[model samples]
Target: MSLANHLEELQRKHGDIERQIDIALSHPSIDDLEIVDLKRRKLAIKDEIEKLKASPTTH
Candidate 1:
């Protein structure tokens, strides 16, 4: 897939992960480690998206 499409998919996945984290926190038990891992993944995806946007596009 193109960079734009990849970014969109990343954003969508990030949103889904965020919601999952929210729900996990609301429960009687919360996994801080899991949340941390998810946050790290989200940040990585954002970084990749930024890099893709910055680089020159090729046809």
Candidate 2:
């Protein structure tokens, strides 16, 4: 796949994770560990997106 396409997919995944975190937060019996894991994954995806955006090919 092209670099742009890969980056888009990663961004979509990051958005999905954000929604998941929101839903988890709305729950009455939310699991702290689960939310933490989701947040961590979201951050990792964000970092990867930034890295890809910085690549010469992406520009």
The lDDT leader among the candidates is: 2
Per-residue lDDT, model 2, residue 50, is 97
Off-target runs (Cα >4 Å) in candidate 1 are none
Give me the runs in candidate 2 sitting further than 4 Å from their true place: none
Q: Across residues 1-59, which tens digit of lDDT does each residue of candidate 2 receive?
A: 98889999999999999999999999969899999999999999999999999988776
Query: How many clashes (backbone N, Cα, C below 3 Å) per candidate?
Result: 0, 0
Candidate 2 overall lDDT versus native: 0.96
Candidate 1 yields a Cα-based lDDT of 0.79
Cα lDDT computed for each candidate against the true fold: 0.79, 0.96
Q: What does candidate 1's lDDT look like per residue over 1-59, in tens digits?
A: 87778879988887887888788778757778988887888788778767877888822
RMSD of 2: 0.7
Quickly count the clashes in candidate 2: 0
